[model samples]
Target: MSVVARTVGLVTANLLAPAPGGRLDLEGATRAGAGVPLQIGFDEIGVPLSEVTFVVVDLETTGGSPTQCEITEIGAVKVRGGEVLGEFQTLVDPGGPVPPMITVLTGITDAMLVGAPRIGEVLPAFLEFAGFGPTTVLVAHNARFDVGFLRAAASRLEMPWPSPAVVDTVALARRTVTRDEAPNNKLGTLAALFGATTSPDHRALHDARATVDVLHGLLGRLAPLGATHLEDLATLGDPVPHKRRRKATLADSLPTGPGVYQFLGPGGEVLYVGKAVNLRRRVRSYFTAAEKRKRIGEMVDLTQEVRPIPCATELEAAVRELRLIAELDPPYNRRSRKPHRRPWIRLTDEPFPRLSIVRSVPAGRSAEAIGPFSSRAAAQSALEALEEAFTVRRCSQRLPVVPSAEARACALAEMGRCGAPCTGAQSLEDYAEVAASVRAGLTSAAGPVVAALRARIGTLAGQQRYEEAAAERDRLRAYLVAARRTQRLRPLWRSPQLVAARRTEDGGWEVVLVRYGRLAGTSTVPRGVNPMPTIDALVATGEEVPAPSTVLGASGTEEAELIADWIEHPATRLVQHEEGDEPLAWPVDGAAKYPLPPTA
Candidate 1:
């Protein structure tokens, strides 16, 4: 039919219509990727019904929340160039308990999907079979629900959708039909009106077929003239496709001590090396976010790999981080030019409180200070450990004093923490000497208690006390990790400052959280705005922390405010780290895996 003729026929029929117009009936919404609203058969925009290719998809979901919900049944049909492609029908394994309502709607029980490979298996096979590829287009009654599933699936698998273009047939039906024609334009009524003799089975494939027929009839009566290409067709309702992604699994990175970590990629490339107080947990989150995921997945798919070198302390981790970067030359390490130093505790006032890595001497000396650890997180952890084990005071030296009669020294002095410069227990000169000794302890052997424990370990081993020796070893490891945690405090954001924490697919990054910028408490993001890691090599270890400093480069001042609001929300929780969790073992150099022959 010519375009002019179709228009004339539509208008003429409108004028001579007995009632108002054909009642446009619509079925369920799209259950896959980025689904749109349920568009009526006759779209609000008046797409004229005749100009576009259409497909109908019916899905029976195990439940809602596409991630948890699996489709029990999927029925789809394509109509383009006025012909239906092969009917798409399949029963998917939900891999979990199926809901009663879903079974009732679909008539597909758990027994049917039980032995089925699971939605993961079914989705890939079905899409491949359904001609979802570069050139394929799709249409559904309601696009949103259907599209959401597709998105979730794709992300879970770490692959981009094969096809993005799709149309909602329900929209066209609504635009062409009048509401007065029927109380509602559900599938059954529309099928009867279109002269399609099929009975409504509520089965996926059956409904899809009925939709195709009705759409075919509409096309026959409405195909626009000279519509030579797919793009030429006017979109009735916007096409909604499924968007897929994996969930994040971070948390457990920030710590009180210092340590080192490696950012690995496919084929074992060292993406970067970093140091943190909490090493194990900080490494896992890189892979979980959306942005980092694509790269990690791609790298893993091409070359699967992972690698991590442990350290005893944050100071050690900082030093090790620089060494690894120098040796590994990971392509992703851009800010490696700066040298790392364990922060030095410097006194601030005349009595000088400990200063660490005094990045710069504050002009004349407003404060005492120490180092510039490879990262601030590491430095803080180290300081904390020292304070705990050495019994050094961590509070600022400039404490408030009571009246002379009341200034009998705080309880800290009584508890041996005050160093007693107040009540003539020690002279200022003598206190300085003691403080100097405390600072010197950083390089000295641990105090008498540690020495005594070491001697015990040696004595137990000499007496063949293997069990005692082993216990001592475990204790030492714990102490090392604890010490590391206390000394380092700057490499990571304060917990809950990171966003979506998850491991990457390729196992390159254990977890990757993003912070759009400083104002956004890092943890509030839950899922940061960075690219997520890939699927194949998954090793999600830690939660993602935002790059608070990155706030500088963003466009507007409001960006900071926007981020601040998100962080302050009562729902935000700090990311926590667990000990001994490790990144997966992987190769440094790219290597190929080959199928093995039969064993000899």
Candidate 2:
């Protein structure tokens, strides 16, 4: 039975549960703020590595898994740009007897734990001591384990959780070290290899300090790789070199929920994406596979990483999957069949600027742009067509203006294509009106273009210009095809998603993942057995497929940026669409979404 299932019965009727022991102390020393962590060495993300705060945390718990365990000890040390500022260590009295095995493992005895303040009494003070300011970030080793406990303890006490963001040093090691660097991830093993320093004892504070040292060592190595934020360090770990994960063991105790999962190769390439309502049960399914070697050869050969995000509901999980797929464009996911690839019609910024074909200009920085086409060739053809039909300039180089009297107001002016500015045939208002029409033509699709073409066709037929009218008809069809082939409107998972995976009892496993869409806070899912959609979908929106730059060398950097954006989306204060029952949405401004895939 899950430890969490057993502890549910421990809550008291009063909102406040009893303190674990008599009040530990009337705490006084002013606590520092928890600041956000940054890849201090890299400058692109703009978060100063020095100014950002890092809290190294370790928790002693009664058992494994926060859902099943109770926290007995919490230790932390705050550091800024590698400088230790202050620290917090406290003991929480677990109301139950300490299990013998746990006592031996942690050396935290019942005697040492007794008479200590319960998590409820000691938490607020510790949170205050952690010193969270607008941007403090936490650091831990295997952070999710500690983070989960902190979350649970805070929920039980009804106190505001002090820190929401964290950095894991283990993840840093995985990113920076060679795949063959270490066979094991035990703290002492990594510290010894990396020349990281920590107290000899395995106490909470010492462990936290060790993690910090190890993280510093990792940063010292990866800074040259150009990591400017913790996200870079956290995600840049080298993928496992071998295929397929080690078989799930009986030791793993899984949780049931909705989430997305990924299989990565040792080189850190995403091999596959899956989801499950119940994390443990879903993941277990893979382990029990009779044809595991054949059915999952790609996964086994390619996978070095496993990532999961938990969701409150199945729908949210699916949504998150779609978002990730869209954003990350993981090579394994479905490829977009858009007719044009970032094919856009650009209105040039220079004088005598005319409509032209271009592939992708920056977003929110347009020179009067419209439509992302299915192919660059399509955009080029469209531009050619428009240039012929309207004598808009096509050359990128500046052209000498002809004397208006001799040129007879150019072809467009004669046909009313423009306001004849060269010949001074119209007022500024007329010129403005013509400019608006040009923009409309660029953005308008087949239906409207056809309607305009039809009228023009009649006018041309009267003038006995049937050839021009027929050409106009063809242009209308092209626009319609482009629009139908490329325009995609789907729901957005604007919020950060959390995916949790653990070992399953059945040999195969399931995972529980959460999707906090852009607007809703969080929704908890019912325990059920089912596979989730895909992450490519959740990360699919508003992304540009990447190209290799001499600087970036093209191994999913574009995709990495997209994933990072999804992970680090700023807080969503208002829902674009209204919905109710969001579990954790209350700030006047939205809370920053988490971007780190692992809870390091």
Candidate 3:
């Protein structure tokens, strides 16, 4: 045998050969120091790397398949901040004969494991030594193999598996060390490249020790890529090298709070806008090897600097992001850049009021609009449905409030589809009553107008007029959605100011302070803390927003839309104030006439 092979074989035998206490002393010979392990699945964005714990592990099995093969040996080194805290090593009888080829490769024969414990006996002890906590991460040369075996064993034994975050050193090396530095990404090859304290010779403990070294080496490389937290390492997959990473320093100044961020190109031209709960972590993520989008990489390359604007809440950040995207018209933004361009169905303020589709709500107009529809077709469909229920005027004439006698009723009047108010056939009082019914239907889906439309649709469907029924259904859906949107916003429009709170995932409360229809401020009522004080503070800090009438016309600003969305959230509950400060009234029985179909 070669000198190197002989030396490695002697070392492996010495370590594997049980001690007087029937435990391996390999850890005592190699472990640097005892480390303090952190909790499992630890996820904090700015947590220092020194506080993170990694359980580097390796396993030797009979074959590749976990079910078909059996694990012969398991080894792991518990590490925290570069210190070796503990070790787990064991040999297991496969409950079957060892393959000759495997024995030759790993030098672990059936005779060596004859009196050893089975996997069922060894796994529990290994898991206990390795621990399962939030801050703990499992590392392996090729993690999939080791993790798969453990998972299979857990399933077979029906043991509750604590699935800690796993990191694959092979993947880490492929991104950290170039092929020129370490030709093939095998465990031994990387071990030698990183100058691991122990050489891997197929024995589990030695291989695991070597893997720990490689992990530390790769972590050093990850520092320049902005991976400084425990959670960062879990997502640090193979990244296509980004040229913009050189400008990664630009994101260093971003705050670790909820906010909107802008990527600016040369001459300070905005290239892209994005929102994140943690500005620093999100902007830093682009510099890491994990960002895979080619477009994002290209944008990052063009980006010369990053600008972060902190907000009071994630919802505020989302609204600010939309506003910034619209204001800058950044080339990278693909949506919500034109919140004002949505269609609205307006009721013209003439003697014979008629529905008119408009992109913007005309200022100083006496017309009331119900919209912000996705398209004109949807608005027109809703108008047609309203006409079916209320036969008002459809003409485009500047008639007197007392109906002009010179007006001519079009084909609609002859077909009994219109009240013929244009020719004075329909009196002003009667027409006003029809207009009131249309307004009620437009504001609430449960109103009489929608009920009439629903009944009409059902009658058509029963008669096998399938196309007519479908058309009516489409009209009803459009009207319902517009009404729902208006219903959510109308409360803010009616109330000068509204304070509300929604339960958060962390059992806290998210308080939103709004003026008119805009979000003025927001704050968090942390768990076990008094929410009233926080809510009061948030209200005191609210910015003065334009009155709802002037600010949110037909289609409101993005911020208004955002606040409306918040008010409609099912978990949101309004805090009781004086009776005089009551917010906009909603349908007490609920808008139940036309139930929305399941989304496609």
Candidate 4:
């Protein structure tokens, strides 16, 4: 058995060794030395298959169902570098008579198991022998059965089950071996086909040994197809179309750094845009079996090139990806695709200045806008809340400064819902006061809005109108959410220039420069180095932004919000600016005084 193991080890070593130029070839086996070391200098995507300790496990059970059945015997062969490391075999007393059928199949009768250790004892020994964690790969012919029985036994014994990475030889055989080579992926059939020295005969140890050979055979077949790492084993049978797999070369040139990657079609059209902490790894994964998205597979089919735009930090990569997705409108990239479509609640440019839902706030009137609400419906709900609080006109019609008698009141005015400013019932001076209140509610002072909504909710609740009260509560909640967002974001957007820094994992400094709430530049200072010079250089070379024309600043509202979130992150430290510049601070009491209405 020892000599046979050495021969199998030699065969496996030759089978898995990379050919000259770091490619595996079935016909190039003669070029490999007897004990060739595993290839070096490859990026560590996952544990190398040659270095992984695999425990080929098999179990004899009293019944088919793990929940109802008891494990009779356990057998596992631990192997690494194609050599047998150790073996674990033990019989477990089920504490019940084995059924005639199970006894006949496994040949483990009650007489043979009289003094065998019970599952509580056997399970601990098996776990200790199998080892734990990433270095260990658990292999079984049909892993579900063996692993299920083990986990059940552990549960029954109240033992901790270390769930290790598993490889099912049945699945692997189906992936690597063809129907012509083997009629079906069964233990007996595969053992014969792979020429295993031990033949499975309904016993645990014999079947586990046969499975070790089957596992090696399957890996030998998968090696030529580029499934050499432990991570590759998980997606062994992935039906990644050849066209998409071939295009993986596009990622070969990308750097392993934080960046935005654009998948370009044949005509140079951007197919998709994405951000990743490691450009090379992320883009390369699209071609591997692990990338199972049908849409992404289709995108890869169309992708003739992958273009990388490396950034200094992850935040920069995220911002650039957002901007590119919005700019290119890549068909395959979802989310953040339409920055222009984000809805905003704006006071229309008119004498009445009714609340309106607009896509983009007109250049100079962003202060009159309260939101880049998540959706048009949310903006509408907030508008209703503002209208409920303040008697500003709900009409969409633009009215002149001095209304003609022909301009009759709308139905809202007739119901006394509006102040009837259009019909001249309310004087211009009085209407100005109403507009001022609405503006204050949207921006600086939301206390009045919250108080009014709260009072309305109380009155409705007093009438036992719970449903209406709930509706008002939702409206107020929406208003408060939008108001709070605006209050936090407005200050950041209004700042002429702001600098912030955060400590990196390596004690380095990740510094960013913001101009009007848009990320202008970023730099990293190495560990144990002076960050001041780098920060000063970053500020001096930062993109020059003009005075913001809108409350959203020079960028889209989403971009401004992204910047605000970064600035407010707990790790971020604001660098104080020279005197006379407005301090980078949100109003302490802004909208904080306006508590949201309780759910009814």
lDDT of 4 by residue, 1-600 (tens): 010111133324322442111111111111112323222112445344666777788999999987898988888888887888777788888889999999889899999888888888788778887776556767887776787788777767777666666677887787778889888989999999989989998788889989988888888886656555544555445677656554655665678789999988999999999998888777767776768788988888888888899999998998998888788888987786665577878787766778888877654665577877788777888888899888899876787777887888888887877988887898878888888888888777887777878898899999999888888888888888888887777666777788899999999999989877788899999999999999889988999988765556677767777787787899999884422123455455457666666654
What's the lDDT for residue 332 in model 4? 89
Backbone clashes under 3 angstroms, per model: 151, 104, 9, 0
User: What TM-score number comes out for model 1?
Assistant: 0.31
Error of 3 at 97 (Å): 3.4
lDDT of 2 by residue, 191-212 (tens): 8776665652557877876777
Q: Write the per-residue lDDT of candidate 1 for residues 1-600, one digit (tens) a residue.
A: 000000111111110101101112233334244444322222121122333334467777877687777677777765544455455667766667778887777677878775656566666755665565333446555555676676687778786665445555555566455777645567787777776646557787778777666665544432332111222123222221111111111112223234665554554666666666544334322332212445444432332223445553333354456656666776656644533223334445545244343443331231123333445564554454344434344555453232234446667777876565545565666666655654443322234324434565688899999787655544443333322221222122222334423323333222223232222211111234333332111124333333233212121222332333333445433333321111111112101111111211
**lDDT, candidate 2, at 261:** 72
Q: TM-scores of all models?
A: 0.31, 0.37, 0.80, 0.78
The global C-alpha lDDT for each of the candidates, from Candidate 1 onward, is 0.44, 0.49, 0.69, 0.75
TM-score of 4: 0.78
Residue pairs that clash (backbone atoms under 3 angstroms), model 4: none
Off by over 4 Å in 4: 1-51, 60-73, 80-86, 89-122, 176-179, 201-206, 222-257, 284-294, 336-343, 348-366, 374-381, 394-414, 420-428, 450-481, 526-530, 577-600
Task: Compare candidates 1 and 4 on TM-score and give the better one.
Answer: 4
Q: In model 2, state the lDDT of residue 360.
A: 51
